[model samples]
Target: MTTQTAKNKAMTERLVEWDKKHYFHPTTPLKEQQAKGPAHIFTHGKGIHVTDVYGKEFLDGVSSLWNVNVGYGRQELADAAREQMMTLAYGSSFFNNSHDVVIRLSQKLASMAPGDLNVSFFTSGGSESNESAIKIVRHYWKMKGQPERKKIIALERSYHGVTMGATSATGVPEFKNMITAIAPDFLHALPHQTECELGDSSAPGYERSIRGIIEKEGPETIAGVILEPVQGVGGIQIPPEGYLQAVRQLCDEYGILMMTDEVITGFGRTGKMFGVEHWEVVPDLMSVAKGITSGYIQLGAVMMTDRLRDELADLSDNVFFHGFTYSGHPTACAVALKNIEIIENERLVDNAKQMEQELWKGLNYLQDTHKIAAKPRAIGLMGGIELLADPDNGTTFEPSTFAAPAVVEECAKRNLILRPLIFGGLNVIAIAPPLIVDKQDIETIIATLSDSIQAFEQRVM
Candidate 1:
């Protein structure tokens, strides 16, 4: 056979063999998928678009699982990584020793983080970052001689991470059913469902419900209250006015540490550097990842207030015994340092702020035109369009009906990659394009999504 024929044959064989073995995808039913065969094979990515092995291009509507804030195929980020690897690729952060890049990135993060979150703890990703925060909170109270203060309050529909510890902290039920029992003492509070037709009454009612949970659990036993400033996996539930402030006050009154998981909302995904900044509510500890290195390299960080660090310092044996081998990998840190610099230099955050208005305007237009759309919520660059089976009655379709999945499939057909909210029957189309996406790309995504929703409506009807 000729060289060209040989390459094509090899590619086809690889796909068939991959289906036969080698891929066990996350968040997918193994038996069903393996029987169906291998999914789309992504060949390359560049600036908010990805091409498959067959060269069909799709707009990265969800920014490749909500990272890639600076978009794809960034040469500067690649260069930074190359330079760091050439110098020093790996280092253990176990001892008192540290590297220049790690120290520099730590200082930069401390400075940019909201409030007095001065101490930094590095992890490989969001799950580990959140896991570290949980350990720190428990350890902080133990050092303070409140060993029984171990209860943690998380919000319903909130997603912290998927580690055994962090997964327990997540309030979605689907993550809980199959897994072994998570640690006890973790309580879930009511989530803010502003998009629900129940109206303004639901906001105060939800806050009161959370307050009741805290009181019943006894404030002394509660170590911290962990929440997402804007619940990402929970259909992009944005808290209403006074909700975050009320929670802050409640935590203060009960002496509970307020932990904000900004893994998705940090580093300009929400226009603001940190989601809590939008509410002006300071958190005791914050967990961040995703855009930290613009998805060029893996890195997550936990930022805690100086007071919390000091409290831990006061105890002779209060060391946080948890970390990953790549906790502060020099290459990752160097890439992140350059990433942040690039974000600042190019004013991507401000660009996100500008594009956010246009994106929301386009989505709102869809809500007005499409009968399936119940409500649309937009905050900065993060937006969600909740689709209802009966918009007139505000009734949601059953999950088994797979309405959202159908819509998602339609979106994929239109070359738009969208993610479905794992919680609730509400069909939410989340849009958080890369901060570097220009107006033309934004328009393309909006138009494609609008067309996809229309096509979905036609089929479902």
Candidate 2:
């Protein structure tokens, strides 16, 4: 080998060794990864693309775990973070201590949030945001003298987070299988999208599922219902028309709080500032993260309605003990403000709205042309293309066949990265690119998927 080749190989070996020795990656098979190393050692990123250590490029179709809303490598975000760190790097948001950026960021979020969602509680990421929401609402109910209202309900196949409370709240079995019994009183309801599929069944839709649960537990024992406005890890399942509205109505009827976990769909991911905006439904609480700061610095927030905030305030005169050390971190807040400014200044939400049509048109064509594309659906930038062995008969390959992973690999070989959700008997390819993606980027994504699907279909044959 040449000298340059030798150097590259040496670097790769060193990286692999170091990672295997020290880095414990999340959601990875530790033993297998330690033996085989990472699939790609990513080094840098730009708008809509990421370059591996080997200098190969790939479209960031998964938006780097559904964050990076402004796309990658925006110097402005860097500058914003640097400027804030230089000014005020760290400040304890404890004891009513606050930073200017944090205060300003809170005000901005309140103004943008729908209905009376006017208060903000900060965390380090989505998981913490969700866990925090659970505590906040349950605490509120307790203060209101309803200590029995401890049960929480979520939609099946939904993903919340991995913390004890958040993991218990998550509806996916894979997330809970490895662990022991999680937080109690966590329940699952049938998703609205699947309701119509089970035609003529006694159980109709989300309404009945939730209603039945409430009846079984007694409404007085339930604290709240937490759900994703547009399900992400649960196969990008979009709520059917009037679905959220019906849920909101149910929550009201049952005297239970409703929280929408917008961790993945918030901040322009769904062509709107918030996913629930599509239904004009005002949830009592909202869990937000990921796109909040475009993943520049870890930041998450729980936005509460004025009514909920006031209830907590009225019920408690003592210090309500709940918050994170990095809660409302000045640097993160500053980065988030700058990121939101960029999103607004660039009209990224509107761009997402327009590009979604482009995405749907392409996915629709793929669905018609490729028999593997059993059902392709997109709402704004979040979507899924369900793969099947035969669309005519709705024949799906057995999970052991690994068809979804094969299709994802096919896409990656073509310099496009896509997330394949294979668990829970799903063969879904999640499509959620950065909101700042342009028309050309959308076309490239579509073409890449089209070719990948065709290749995968041929390989299966």
Candidate 3:
């Protein structure tokens, strides 16, 4: 090899060694990583593609953890971060203090948020956002002299975050099982039970639905209901028509707060500024992250209705007593502001909506070409296809088969990156490319995934 090539190889090898020795990855198998080294050492990204340290490039099908809505390598976001850092590297939101960028971002979010969600409490990311929301609702009840209303009801198969409260609120068994001891007062109900949520006692599984649980546990003791507008980590499960509306009505009838976790579906991931807008349902509280800055910076916020904020302000005699040091970091806020401006100026939301049609066509094609592909689902750019051993009979693959991960690995071999959502006995392949992707990009991703699925079929069938 040439001298430059040799130098690059040496650097890659050294970095790999250091990573195997010291790096502790999240949501990874420690023993496997230590034994085999990292799967890919990404060095840089531009648009919807990321390049590894070994100079191999791949299309990022999952948007680097379902963020990066505006894609990667945007000079505008970089400049915004730099300018804000130069002006004010860090600013805390403590003691009721604030900064210009934070103030501006809050107002922008308020304007963009659904209904009267005009107030924002900032955090560093999704977990913090969910944690703050949980605390806020519980604290609200306490301030209202009903501290017994501390129970939070989440939906089964939902993925909130990894923080203590978020983890407890998560309905994914694997996540909650990670720790033997989790926070209390977090209950999970059957997901997407529209009739049951609407108080249809005759519906199948009604006793396990949110409404049923509230009634069984005493609605007076329930503080709020938390659910994702579009379940992300739980196999991109889209709620049936009127599902969200039914949940909102149930919460209203029971005097409980309805909170939607928009961490994944926010910022146009679902063809709208916020996913709840599709159903015209206004949640009392909403937690958002990820695309708020298109993953350029870590930032999140818990937004509340004006009425709720006013009530909390009136009820509390002391400080709220919760916030992060970087609650409203000026640099992060600046990056977010610029990132949002780019999204609006470029009309990426419209692009995502337009691309949904193309994605749907591709998903259908995959189902038609592959006998194992079934239950195709898509909303905007977020979509998933279930892999079954026998589609006609709805038979799932054995857990030990690891079918989804195997197909995803085949896609990776074809220079494409995809995520397998195997949590909760699911064998689903999630497809959520960046909003910047076009028809050609969608075609490439679908074609690659088809070949990968075929390879898996040949292996198993």
Among the numbered candidates, top lDDT falls to 3
Q: Write the per-residue lDDT of candidate 1 for residues 1-461, one digit (tens) a residue.
A: 99987897688767967765987788787887777765567879998899987678999888887889998998999999999999998888886768888999999999898789988999988999999999889988888889999988898888888898799999888888769788788888777533221323344554445566666777789999899999999889889876778778778877889899999999998888889988898899999999999888899999999998887777856346777899889999999999999889998888888888888888888888888875787776788888888889988877776777778778899888987774755578888888997778878887888888898888776
Clashing pairs in 1: none
Candidate 3 wrongly placed segments (more than 4 Å): none
Once fitted onto the true fold, the runs of candidate 1 whose alpha carbons sit more than 4 angstroms away are 1-6, 193-208, 317-319
**Which sequence of candidate numbers ranks them by TM-score, best first?**
3, 2, 1
For residue 54, model 1's alpha carbon misses the true position, in angstroms, by 0.7
- For model 3 the TM-score comes to 0.99
CA error at residue 278 for candidate 3, angstroms? 0.9
> Model 3 over residues 1-461: C-alpha lDDT tens digits?
99999998899898988999999999998899899899999989999999999788999999998999999899999999999999999988898788899999999999899899999999999999999999999999999999999999999999999999999999899988879899999999999999998878999999899999998999999999999999999999999999999999999999999999999999999999899999999999999999999999999999999999999999977988998988999999999999999989999999999999999999999999999999999999999999999999989999999999999999999999999999988999999999999999999999999999999999999
lDDT of 2 by residue, 223-273 (tens): 999999988998888888887887888789888999999999999999999
What is the lDDT of every predicted structure here?
Answer: 0.84, 0.89, 0.95
Q: Give candidate 2 regions above 4 Å deviation.
A: 1-4, 193-208
- Candidate numbers, best lDDT first, in rank order: 3, 2, 1
Ten-residue region with minimum lDDT total, candidate 1: 193-202
